[model samples]
Target: MGLIVASGLCLALWVVLWCFHIAARDAAMISFSLFLVAAAVRTVGEQVRQSNSREG
Candidate 1:
């Protein structure tokens, strides 16, 4: 949830920067967005593993 929220904020900032002609900042926002996505994926994977272990 936190990761998703952060990604959403990053997406907003990216758009804002693009609109204002701030090309350099876009790189940072893009990286942050990617990081958030990776973190979210890892979090989901951990939850799945925990659930599977409990069921097994």
Candidate 2:
């Protein structure tokens, strides 16, 4: 459940950055990319984990 919420939060962050063009401090700009990567990795990892769990 927490992971699901985090995915939503990443989407909102992206909307703000790309759609609304929110100004973030120079260092914070890295956060947007990190969020995307984290979401993707988390989703892929979860899928792989679940598949492996079900295989046995």
How much lDDT does each candidate structure score?
0.93, 0.85
Candidate 1 residue-pair clash tally: 0
Tens-digit lDDT track of model 1 for 1-56: 99999999999999997877766678789999999999999999999999999999
RMSD of 1: 17.6
For residues 1-56, what per-residue lDDT tens digits would candidate 2 score against the true structure?
99999999999898888754545564477887899999999999999999999996
Error of 2 at 52 (Å): 0.1
TM-score of each: 0.60, 0.48
Can you tell me which runs of candidate 1 are displaced by over 4 Å? 1-21
Each candidate's number of clashing pairs is: 0, 0
Return the top candidate by TM-score. Answer: 1
TM-score for candidate 2, residues paired by index: 0.48
Task: Please state the error at residue 46 of candidate 1 in Å.
Answer: 0.2
Could you tell me which residue pairs clash in candidate 1?
none
